[model samples]
Target chain A: MKVRVHVSLKNGVLDPQGRAIHHALEGLGFDGVNDVRAGRLIELDVADTIADEALDEMCRKLLANMVIENYRIEKVAA
Target chain B: MPFTAAVITFPGSNCDRDMAVAIEEISGGTVHRVWHGDAALPDGLDLIALPGGFSYGDYLRSGAMAARSPVMQAVVEQAGRGVPVLGVCNGFQVLTEAGLLPGALMRNAGIRFVCRDVKLKVENASSLFTSAYLPGQTITIPVAHHDGNYYADAETLDRLEGEGRVAFRYLEACNGSQRDIAGVLNEKGNVLGMMPHPERMIEPAHGGSDGRKLFESVLHGLNALA
Candidate 1:
């Protein structure tokens, strides 16, 4: 089994990298871009029998920092 | 009574020696060098410092690997027992990664490494780390890192400020830190995590010695406790 974790900075938090990217897009003549927020996608290969609780623990403990980022877990069948 | 301090050195910790020198010079006591692989720390430690640098080459996130090392387990236990722990730069990252401190340090908002002297306002003068400074006083300290931008949720930030847990705040915009937080103290006030390298500013030859007061303050606090 494989799992994917999507980590993103919470709303209302300043995302400088995202802002820079948005600026670049505007300079490139792309309009209608309201905002840009950068995030990370982490893929994990775990045991087939891994439980959802364990995966949640992994995200809470190491995969994502709850203070600045939020994470969502997605299970993908291998 | 001499102060006994330990400086933990992880593989890639470039500032461990500098931290030890500052502790020894300020406390006028024995400075023990502890390795990251050690499962236990020296007995009766008055202070434990985690110095800055790309610990574990900043793999899997800055300070993530080093934070899970055997030695950090001991450091956490010691900190829980009320021993003062100061984490600087990458050390600050390690403290947050190890769950000893609140919040995490992220990459600079500008996507460029920032290296220069930054003015910080002392917010809490009661912690073992910042007692030497007056509230609202600004002090200049050097910051050199790519991941010095601090981040925390709004509620957590509010709680930290309300509880007087915020130890230092940037006087000007140096990084994209939320609330301009440059440093913070743990709930117990015995642990501190900051991006500025106070250890680097302890010697006059380093351009300024304004940071010496931090070490002196911790030593005084420990001595009073003794």
Candidate 2:
């Protein structure tokens, strides 16, 4: 199975990298950019028998820091 | 009894030697340099220090990987037994990531690496690591890091203030830390994590002696217990 985890800073948490990117885009003369928030996408290849609970555990334990980030899991078609 | 301390060295920890020397000189004790792969700490240690640097090269967030290294498990266990732990800079990040302390160190709000001496006000001078300083006293220490902004929920921040667990606060903005907090103590007051490098300020040659009092305070506190 192929799994993808999307990790992003929570809404209230500040994102300095995202802000820098937003500023860079403005510097390049791009318009209509109100805000920017950056996140990470991690892909994994796991056994077909891997349970959903195990995937959730993976995210909770190591894939994302719950303190300031949230994660979503997506399954890709084989 | 002779004072004893251990300084943990993760692969990229550059300040371990400095920490060891500071502890040895201030406590007049045996200071052991422990490796990250070691499963256990030397027995019956008085203090455990986690020094500053890009541990594990700051991969997966600063101090995140190193917090899970084998040695940290023992560090946590020993800390649970009321052993004093002091973590500076990356060590502060590790302490938060390891759940030994609350909150997290985020990217500096200004989005730049900050390195220089800054003024810090002693917020709580009665902790095991702060007994030598007077309340509200100001001291100078050097802080070098990219992700030093401290973040926690409003409720938690309020609780930390109410409990007087905030150990040091920047007199002027240094890293965009919440409430300008520079250092914090655990609920039990046995653990401290800060962004500034107190070890770097322990001598006249190093710029000033403001940091020496911190080491001395810990030494005197431990001796008192003994």
Candidate 3:
């Protein structure tokens, strides 16, 4: 099994990196840019029998800092 | 038994030597060197210091990986027993990631790796780390980090203010930290995490010795307790 974890800063939290990228885009003459926020995607390979509860625990423990970020797990067939 | 302290060194830590030197100079006591992979801390430590640097390569997040290292488990345990721990710069990030402190340090608001002497106000001078400074006194300490912006929920921020947990505050815009907080103390006031490097400012050749008083104050507090 393959799992991808998407971790993003929660709303109301400042994303300075995202803002910098937004500025760079505007400087390059890019248009149609709204607010930009950045996040990370972590891919993992695991046994198919791995339960969602176990995956959630991983996110809570190491994959994401719950204080400022949120995470979602997507399971894909290998 | 005079002011024994330990400085935990992760693979990329660059300031452990400086921290050790400061402690040795002020405390005139044994300074134990501990590695991140080590599982045990030395017995009867008066202080534990997490020095500044890109620990664990700052991979996942600043200090995030190092926070989960084997030694931090023991560090956390000792901290629960009221052991005084000081985390400077990246060390501060580790403490927050390790759940020993509140809030997180994010990228600088201007998206720059700020490295310079920043003026800081002694917010809580009574802390073991800041007793040498008068309340509201301004001191200069150098801050060098990219992810130094401090963030916490409003309630937690209010509580830290109310409880005098804010040990130091930036005197001017340096890293865009919330409430200009540069250092914070734990609930029991035994653990302190600060983005600025006091060790860097200890020697007169570093241009100022304002930071020396902090280490001196720690030793002074310990002696007073003894």
Candidate 4:
């Protein structure tokens, strides 16, 4: 199974990289951008039998830092 | 027993030597260099020092990978027994990532790496690491890192503050750390994680000796216990 983990900073946490990207967009004459937030996408190739609980544990243990970030797991079409 | 300390060195740790040297010079202790792959710590260790560096290339997240290394397990277990742990710069990030400390270090608010001496006020002189400094005393220490901005929820922040676990606060705006916290102590006050590199400032040749007092303080506290 292919899994995608989307890791993003929590809403209330400040995102410096996101802010920098937003500024760059504005500098390039791009408009109508209200805000920008950065995130990481991690793809994993795992055995099809991997349980959701195992995936959740991976995120909680190593894939994401729960203190400042949140992660969502999605199954990708093989 | 002689003052003994172990400095855990992850693959990319650059400051482990500096930390060991600082402990040897100030604490006059036997410093052991422990590899991150080791499963156990030295016996009767007085201190466990995690040095600053881009461990595991700061991959995934700063200190995230290194935090889960084999050695950290032992460090965490020892810390639970009230062993004094000092984590500087990247070490601080590891402590938080390892769940040994609260909160997390984020990217600098300015979106640039900050590397320089910044003033810090000793928020809690009673900590095992800050006893050499007076409460509220402003001290200069060098901070060099990209992800030094500390973040925690309001409730955790309030609890840390209420319990006097905030050991050091940036006197001036250095990183966009919440509440200007530069260093924090674990609930047991046995672990301290700070962005500034006190080990780098232990000698006058390093430009200032303000960092020396921290090692002295820890050694003093441990000796007192002994």
Q: Where is model 3 more than 4 Å wrong at Cα? A: none
Instruction: Please give, for residues B1-226, the per-residue lDDT of candidate 4 as tens digits.
Output: 8899999999899999989999998977699999999999998989999999999999999999999999998999999998899999999999999999999999999988999999999999988999999888888999999999999999999999999999999989987999999999999899999999998887779998999889989888977887
Using lDDT as the measure, what is the rank order of every candidate, best first?
2, 3, 4, 1
Please tell me how candidate 2 rates in CAPRI terms.
medium
TM-scores vs. true structure, each candidate: 0.92, 0.98, 0.99, 0.99
Q: CAPRI band of model 4?
A: high
Candidate 2 DockQ vs. native: 0.77
TM-score (C-alpha, index-matched) for candidate 3: 0.99
Residue-level lDDT of model 4, residues A1-78, one tens digit each, is 889999998888989899999999999999999999999999999999989999999999999999989999999989
TM-score of chain B of each: 0.98, 0.99, 0.99, 0.98
Query: Per-residue CA lDDT of candidate 2, range B1-226, in tens?
Result: 8998999999999999999999998888999999999999999899999999999999988999999999999999999999999999999999999999999999999999999999999999999999999999999999999999999989989999999999999998887899999999999999999999999999999999999999999998987887
lDDT of 3 by residue, B1-226 (tens): 5679999999899999999999998788999999999999999999999999999899998999999999999999999998899999999999999999999999999998999999999989999988989999999999999999999999999999999999999989988889999999999999999999999998889999999988888888888898
Q: Which runs of model 1 end up more than 4 angstroms from their true locations?
A: none
TM-score of candidate 1 relative to the true fold = 0.92
Error of 2 at B78 (Å): 0.7
Between candidates 1 and 4, name the one with more favorable DockQ.
Answer: 4
